[model samples]
Each structure stands twice: as structure tokens, then as C-alpha cells.
Target chain A: MTDLLRTPLYGLHLELGGKMVPFTGYDMPVQFAGIMAEHQHTREKAGLFDVSHMGQVILRAESYQAVAGAFERLVPMNVLGLGEGRQRYGLFTNEQGGVLDDLMFANRGDHLFVVVNAACKEADIARMRAALEPDISVTYIEDRALLALQGPAAVDVLAAINPAAGEMKFMDVATLDLNGAQCWVSRSGYTGEDGYEISVPADQAVDLARALLAHDDVMPIGLGARDSLRLEAGLCLYGHDMDEDTLPAEAGLVWAIQKARRAGGEREGGFPGAQAVLEQIASGAARKRVGLRPEGRAPMREGVELFATSEGGEAIGKITSGGFGPTVGGPVAMGYVPVDLAKADTTVFGELRGKRMPLSVTSLPFVAANFKR
Target chain B: MKYTEEHEWLLPEGDLIVVGITAHAAEQLGDVVFVELPEVGTEVTKDEDVVVIESVKAASDILAPLDGEIVEVNEALTENPGLVNEDATGGGWFFKMKVSDAAPMDDYMDEAAYNKFIG
Candidate 1:
């Protein structure tokens, strides 16, 4: 087998007894204590995650507005309206009505910084470089390592380390000196809880992780818990809930598209595949991504076909992502089903092995989000 | 103790052999959330899947080894499945089955060989 890439926190993850596994070509930690325990720890106290494998790119230009307009051409989100020090979720759609990847972009008052999924980073960077001008440089921050401190105690733990972290609000980003290294800290994360994503210099990543783990409430978590936490938060896993054939509206990411890009808006359908995406927004998506809560103890899994009922029922949809949600105390999954079946508490059936189990189409986010306002 | 390459452990307990996953398998599987096993009295063949273990992230199938009919199962796992995580090979045994006949167990490993295989 080919060797997997290791993150900057590789040594530390080993030291903290992280169960390393191959994830998206990276030899990443899947769990430390355990998936359920680490998941519970993040929900109740604080969890420190090494997300250095994610792609962090800095879009440098003469001004933030210049890059914002160029960026708005790639995704459906209203990048031009984003204020300074503000971050917004965006999607890169292809020429066809499909989502290429989901990303987080921040207006740093001077330039734009975007973080995309680790697996799609190189492709995303290549696409941006080909589409933008030479002066509008897109540089991937290869020297930086990202860490996420999430949960109820994340804020207090961060503020204790850097007093400036206390001043930031949700979706706020600021470049501050964390310890001795210059770092970009954002008051946002994938977990439903209030958290911060800190982009620190690669050389000092170990020190930052050590500092966060020192807090009594903070425990080192791994990818296993991260998946469960994000699922409960109703966030989409790029390749799972969305893909090259999945549209933004169909993936339940319509909120990411501002009114400016919708039909009858000021700047209608300016991004790639605008015609199809805008039309879907106006008429509504045929198949929408919705949360599914399986009834009973058996947790459903991905690729399990969905049926109308247990008794020779018609096929409706298939589960894209399914797992046991620690917080939800049962099986929670996300899939694209017909819009008629996407309503609240619409009972569906998940075909597992040979038997079919009733799976209800609950709303997104099995657990209520606790994002800091 | 006989170990399968799939990480299952079959302990020779006289005629009623007990089956469970190895500790290495449990650690790799992470936390076991739910386990669905075949009902007692169901006939099974050697190396056939008879139990399904669900972790928080993925599901794993536990295969039967030299099996005939399932006699008993670890019912405690239905409510407290974490037992597999706590003690995978001991009290966390999945089920007990009456062996039709011990097949040519040449492919399976002993405890010492299994340890080296995992490493």
C-alpha cells in the first residue's frame, strides 16, 4: 500500500495514544480514549482536534473587495457582501449543477483566507489558479497547521491561553500572536458547540496542542469523534452528503447561497452552473438532504438502500452517511430522499443485510447546535 | 484459543465453543455501540457471518468458526454493548455454538501467532 501522509501533530497524536488510521490519504488519528468517550467529552467539556490535514489557502490581492468579487464568481455565496473579519461558508460548484467542495472563507480586512476539505484542497487550488488572474495569487498555507478546540469549555480554555480570544464573536477571524508564533484564530468549527479553529505555524503546532490539552476540561479527540460531532450538528461530509453530482440546494446547503445569487435578485446566477442551481432554488429540489433517525438499536450505515416500507416497498433513496450519534443516543444518518419524504418525522425504511428497519426523516441536526453568537 | 485472520477468536470450550472478537479487533473497531447476533437455534456454517457489531463510525461482521447451531448469546450486549470494548475476549463473548466438527483449522492462528500477525 502507498504511504499515507502524516499531519504536523503526528508525534503528539502518538504520544497521547491516538489510534491512527488512513483518512483522506493522511495517517490521522481516528480516536484517543474512544469514539463514544471522546465524543461525549467534546459535548460536555472540551475537545482538542488536530485538523492540520485540511487545506488552508490565502488569496492575496490588492484589496479584499477584489478577491471577494473573484471568489463570488466560483461559489454561490455572497462573498462581496462579507464584511471585514467575518467568515462565511461557501461551495465551489462545477459547470454542471453539482457541488465541487464546501469551504470556509474569511475576509481578513486586507485579503481573503479560505480553508477547504483536505482531500479536495489541491484540486480546489488548481481550479482557483486557473480561473483567477496572475496578480490574484492563490497560495496554499503549507507551513501552517490547524487545530480545533470545540465544546462548552473551548472558549474559556482558549481565553485562558490568549486573552484576545475572548473578544472574538462567532464567525469572527483575527490574526493574533499565539504564544510566539503568528496565528489566525477563528471563532467557528464543525461541531455544534462553541469552538475555535486556530491556524498556527507548523513548527509550533505541537506546543499549541500541548497548551490546549493542559486544560482540565480539554481532552484530545480524534477523527472518529469529529465525525459523530459534525453529524449531530447536521454538517455535511463533502464526499458523503455531497459530491460532484450533488447540487447545493439538494444537499440542504441552500442557506449557504445568499439572496444575491438567487433568481430575481440583484446578482442572479453569476457563479458556475448558475442556470441550473437558480432554477432548482426557484422550483425546489426534487431530492433533498435530510436527517434520518433509525428506530431501534440497530444503527444504519452508508449505501444502505431506502424503501417505502418493509413489505415489498418502492425504493425512495439511499443513505449517504450513517452512524451512531453519541449525543443523540441512537443511530443518526443523512441522505438525499424525495422532497415529499424529507418532511419532519416521515417514516422510511433502511435496508440492512436482508431486513428493513424503519428510519424516520427527522430534521437536520439530530442534536441542537450550541454555536456562540 | 484459535484466531482467524479476520480478528475473531474461537475458544475451545469442550463441545460448546465460545466465539468473540479479539482485543486487537475491538481496539481497531473503537467503541462498540450495538451488536446484532443470530437468534439461538439458528444453524450456521464455519466462516459464515452470524453476528454484526456496530461501532460509532462503522459496522463489522463477526464470522462463525466450526459452527453448527447457536446455543446462547451474550444478551447483556443489547443494552450495554460497551462490554465488548471493556472486555472483548472474556465476558464480552458474543455467542456459544455447538461445533459440528472441528474443520481442518490450518489457516487460523494460535494466540502467540496471532500476536505476531497483528504487530
Candidate 2:
């Protein structure tokens, strides 16, 4: 508590009656009005999130092609083929075919812009510097603050200030002006909502956030709502959902690996763990992540062991991320299970305390995504 | 009304003492999503965890304030758990217990003392 860092909007959060809690060494707002209220507000309206804790980086080389080519060596995604002004989800893999970290990278024409999880930022920066340094410089953008304006009304709220926001399609990244601040805006977010993530100068972050929050439809959302929103969206939370030992195939993230980087595509097998990852892709992983819907109202939170039978049997899997999904109106969870039990409608059991409660294997995105095409 | 260190409030009425969490406890717990009440006829001892209360953030237990037998529990909590957040002291009451010995109620703190204890 003594050494925890604070975002530029830390004071603003307290001013709005936010409950501050420690998150990844930073003191962040866990909730403002209330978790349930803020969550419902974000789904019904617009939510302003201070994501300044996340790492923003710039990877620059002589050309975008050079940087993309260098970055392609570390990730499984098709980085070299990424179009300028567009962003794509990516992952860094290890030699064991496990994921290092999941991130979003945008081809900014002049350089590539990367946003990584706050917990993995330091290691990610070190990894990039070691792998693509000197020739391709990895610059951590510390002077900027990131804010995500999410939900259905997020577009109109942001567009009212910068009309260009309305023109941007999902995954589009561009440099736009918002309330006199030059911001790197992306039409993508973790919440599966049609929204924009704006990167602004640290000094101007508070003003821009205040400007967006001034709209009647916009409310200040904290990390608590942010987690619930993403959980309902079927999005993975880095360390909880996938980690250094979890393969992309097992985590069900193979779709992000474009055809060009797969087994027989244009640039086949250059990334770390390409062999193991491709092998799993060709056949199938032993265990796979699946959506779990507990039959009862009680949430089967993270670390709750799952069983094959309701009453007995050895632990088959473990819930990775679980909580009451506000929009789903019930408990939603994600966990790994044997491939046979990973399919939707399969009946599984989660052990709550001493009882084995029934849970149905379900399709993800407990609530449908509201992303704009 | 008497209060315990756990933030539970007890209001004596005849032989039964109504039990519920204070507004401060409810507020700290955030939004209550589910409540698992003990059986009405179950005998309870002081400090025994009886009610299982789950909010969006975490799960907590409501302990028995004194040795008693649970006579009645508010069934409304099963359908609308938010009642605990709306009116913790009134409609949000957990259960009514007939105390085996009402003398222990004297050791509990009053409203003013409980308020100071929280501070």
C-alpha cells in the first residue's frame, strides 16, 4: 500500500467516490457507485475507464515492414501482413508451445503500437528488447495515459467531441484530437462493446476523461465493472485465463493465428513453440478451455476444482475465472477440461465448499458481443 | 438494538431476537447477490457462522450473536438479495432466533458504541 503507483486519474477517482484498491502494484478504483450499478451503467450507457496502468509501447524500425517482420518472429499472429491503421490481437509464445502473454498491436504505418497487460509489461518490454532491439527499438511510452470509453453510447459520446470517432470501424487505430489533446485512438476494447481506447498525454488525460464523463450517458467505470464486462464478453483475462504454460490451442486462441502463420501458410513455423503449437493445431490439445455455467446462484470463483461427476470422482479441471455476470443475471465462469467435456451442453460439476454443484458446459460470451463491424 | 464486532445488529423482541447486518457491513459488502439462510429450526451457538451471504465481490458469513434457536428467516432474501443493500436494518433482517439465555445481550454494544467501534 505504501509504494503502490497511482494513475494520472487517481485523484479524479477519489473525487468521484471511487473505492481504491491495489491492482498490479497500482492503486486503482475497484468501483465507484457500486459494482452492480456501475456494471449495469456500462452495459446500458457509456463507461470511462482509466487504463493507464497498462503498458503502451512503440516498436520502430527503418520501416513498418522491418518492425513487423521482427515482431513476427516472437508471436504466432500474422504481424507482417497487418494493414496500417488496423489492430490485431496477438500472443507471445514460449518454446514449450505455451503463451508468454497476450497483447494487441496496431500497425501505425511509421511504427507498431502495442498495448500489453500491466502485470506482464516489464517482462514483455524485456522480451521485446532482447529479441528485436538495436535494429528494431522497443520504446515504452511512459508519458501517456490510456482510457477506454466503452459501451453502446460510447461512440456518440466520443464522437460529439471528435467526429472522427464515429467514422472509425472496429480495430481501426488512428491519431485523433480530443479536447486539444493528440490521442492515439483505437476502435477496440476488452469489453466486447463498440468503443474506443484513447491514449493521451498524461497531463491531458484528466481533462479528456472529464470531457467524456460530462456526457449524461457516460459514467466513470472502475476495474470491478471492467472485469465483469470482459468476463461476460468471453474475453480472456491474461494471467487468470491464459499464462506462460497455457498453449494457444488449449486456451482456444487459434483463431487469432491467421492462416498465413499456420502450419502450411506463407510464413509457417518461425515463432517460438511453432512446432508444438502447430502440432496441437493439427491434432488437438489434451485439455481445452470451456465456458462453465454453474446451475446455482452461488459463484464458483477461481481455483474451485471441477469434477466429472456431481457426487464424486477425481478433480477433472479447475475454474480459472468465475464470478456473477451482471448482464448474464447468473454466474459465469471459464476453465479447462478434457477435450471430450469441452463441448457446449456437456454436463460438468464444480465443487463449491463440500458439495458438487452441476454446471453445464456452454458456449462463450455469456452475453452477446456488441462490437461494431 | 445491540451490535457485535462482526457488524451484526440484534434487536430483542419478546423471546426472539431479530438478527441482521448493519448498514455499514452491508455497504462494505457491496451488492448482495445471494444469501443462504440456515434452517429455521436449527439450534445455533454464539459465534457460529449460520448465514452464507455472497455479494458481487466476495462471500461472507453471518454469525450467531448468541446461543439460540432460529425460529424464522426472511425468505424474501432468496428472491431479492439486494434487500440487504436497500434496507439492511429493516426489511433486510436475516433471521429471528429465540435466545436460550438473553443475559448475553447485555454484553453487546449499543448503537452509539457500535458507531464509535466502527470508526
Candidate 3:
């Protein structure tokens, strides 16, 4: 096994008696107090996550607009309309319009800040470098650490440290002085809740994390709860729900692609697989992503085969991510199936442990999102 | 009472041996949420996976310490499963089994030795 990477807050995690496990090549805490408690705490109160392992990349150029235009050509998003101090969730696709990774892009005052998943950071950087215009430069901010403070009480707790933070709306960004340290705070998160993603200097990460935990409503949450929380919120985990073989259209992320990028548009940004993506968008994709609600208490996990009732019970899809949604109080799953079977309220079957469990194809996001917007 | 190296404890109860996870194992597992016990009369061999336990984070297998036929299971665990987390070595007793052979008893460590082994 490869040696696990340590984050800036590794010592703090150890000090808190965190149970460390290998996650995305990093020694991350799977739980602290307990998984169910931590998961519930985040939903009811607030939870601090040491997400320093996520990669931070700075897109620099002479002007912000120039870099934004160049970035729009690479990813399928409305970057041109993004104002200063705003962040947008988007995806980087391959030649076949398949998503390489999903990431958050923020238009900082001078540079564009991009956060990619830790496991796919290296590949995402390479793709950005290859796709970015010659004049636009890209720099990986490895010296920085990312922290996420999420839950219902996130706003109140975060405001205690950074007073101005409460003013930022969802997807908005602001460079603030956090306890005398320069930090970029974004009103966004992976969990379907109102939260903030803070990028701080590597040295001061532990200090900020400590201050956040000092609040009564804030507690240290681990990767275990984080996965369940995101899963309950119906968020797509990169490697689990999306990969190079999965197209954004099929992944139910067509909204991320701006109308201008569609076929027969007056303005066109020549990104990879534009022809295929536009065709899929115009005619509707063959297969589409859908949420599944399995009938029983047993959690349906990844790799389980999905059978289509419409196709005479023929297996047509497979689960990409599945688990017990703590907040939803049942089992929820996401998978790709034929377009006809991907409609909401459609009945399907998931073969779990040799038994065919009845499932319903529902709309994306099993639970209501609590984003600040 | 004796303990296996894998941190399972076996208590002598008449002709049957009561089995449960050790305190050390429960502490390591954090919080127990669900327990999957084998059916009564199921035959099991030493070191065989006879029961499965799930915590909020991950699932774990409970290995049988001796060859036996399952006689009784802790049905209470199905509801108040947290018993395993609160008192793993005591009230968390998973099942009772009639020993098929007494030879494997020699492999189990005594309380003092098992404590030292865990430490």
C-alpha cells in the first residue's frame, strides 16, 4: 500500500483521537465521537471537516475576463456571466464529453480559484494545463489548505470568527481576514446545506479548525459522515457517481452546460467533444442519471446491478453510489439507466445480495438542499 | 471464560458456550448499529465467520472461536443494538452454541492472558 498523505491538520486530528483511515490517498479521520452522532450533529448543528487534501489551483492571467474566457472553453459552465467574488460548480470532460472530474471554480479578484477532488487533483491539473490557452498560466496552490464548515448552524458559528461572512450568499466568494490570516471563504459545500469552504495558509489551518471546533455547535466530523451526508443530499462523488466513462449529460448535469455552448449558437467555445455533447443535449441522451429508493432497510452499495422492468427485467444499469441516508431515514442510491427508465417515479429493481429489491427512480437530490441561496 | 486472539470472548454456560465481542473489539468498532446473527442449528467451525456486525461507519465479521452448533442467538440485539457498544463483553452476548469438540478450548487465552494479549 502507498504511504498515506497527511494534511496540515493531521496532528490536530490525532490529538482529538480521530480514527484515521486511508481516503483519497490521505490519512483522513473516518470518525471521531461516532459516525451516527457526527452525521446527526452536522445535520442538526455544524461540523468542521479537514479538507486540506483537496487541490487548489490558481488560474492567472493579465485580466480576469481573459482567463475566464479561456476557462469557459475548457469546462462546460457559464463562466463569462460569473461576476467577481462568485464560485460555480462545473465539470471537466474528456473527448467523449465524459466527466473527468467535478470541481468548484471561483472568480477571485485577480485570479480564478479552482478546487478539485484530492484523488483526481493530479489528472485535473494536467488536463487544465493542456486545455488552457498559452497566455493563461495555471499554478497549483499546494501551500494552501482547505477547510469546510457545514450544517444548519454553520452561518452562526462561522460569523463568530469572521463577522462579514454572514453576508455572503450561496456561491459567493470573499477574501477575508480570518483571525489575522488571509483566507478565501466561499458560501458553498458538498453537503446539501448552508456552509462555507475556507482556503487558508497551510500553517494556520489547524488553528482555524481549532477555533471552529471551540464553538458548542461545531464538532469535528470525519470522512464517514461526510460521505453519508453527501450521499443523502444526492451529491455526486467523483469516482463513485462520475468518471471518464460517464458523460455529463448522462450524469444529469446538463444544467452545468450553458445554452451558448449548445449547438447552433452564435458564440462557440471550442471545447473537447462539443459536437457529441450538443447532439446529446438537443436529442436527449440515451441513458440518464437517476436517484433510486430501495425498498428495505438494507443499504444498496456501489457495483450492484440495476435491472430495468421496462426491458423485460433485463439488466441495463448499475449503481454508482449507494448508502443509508441518515437524514432521509432510508436507503438512497444514484445510478445510470436507460433514458426511458430514468424518469421520476418509475419502478426498478436492484439486485442486492442475490435478492431483487424493488426500487423507485426518483429525481436527483433525495433530500431538500439547504444552500444559503 | 476465555478469549480468542481475534478479540471474541466465550463463556461457559452449562453445555453451551456464550459468545460475544470483547470490550476491546467494541471500543475499536466505535458504535454498533446492526447485528447479523446466524440462524439456530447452523454448524460453524473454529475461525469461521458465523456472525456479522455493522457499525455506523463499517461492517465487521464475527469469527467463531470453536466448532459448534448454534443453539441460541441474542434476539434483543435487533432492537437495542447499542448494547454491543455500551457493554460489549457483557450484555452484548451474541449467541450460545453447543460445542462440537472441546479441543479448541486449549487455544483460547485465559482472562489475565487475554488482557495482556490485548494490551
The C-alpha interface RMSD of every prediction is: 0.9, 0.7, 2.3
Q: In model 1, what is the error at residue B97, expressed in angstroms?
A: 2.1
Which is the better candidate, 1 or 2, if ranked by TM-score? 2
Top candidate, metric lDDT: 2
Docking class of 1: medium
Query: lDDT: which is higher, 1 or 2?
Result: 2
Following a full C-alpha superposition, what root-mean-square deviation does model 2 have from the true structure? Answer: 0.9
TM-score of 2: 0.99
DockQ of every candidate structure: 0.79, 0.80, 0.41
Clashing pairs in 1: none
Q: TM-score, each model?
A: 0.94, 0.99, 0.92
lDDT of 1 by residue, B91-118 (tens): 8899998876777455689989999999
Candidate 3: misplaced stretches above 4 Å?
A1-3, A264-269, A308-314, A344-347
Q: Any residue pairs clashing in model 2, and if so which?
A: none
lDDT of 1 by residue, A167-262 (tens): 899999998777677889999999898999999999999998888898899999999899989999999999988999998889878889999888
The DockQ of predicted model 3 stands at: 0.41
Question: Whose lDDT is higher: candidate 1's or candidate 3's?
Answer: 1
The DockQ-based order of candidates, best leading, equals 2, 1, 3
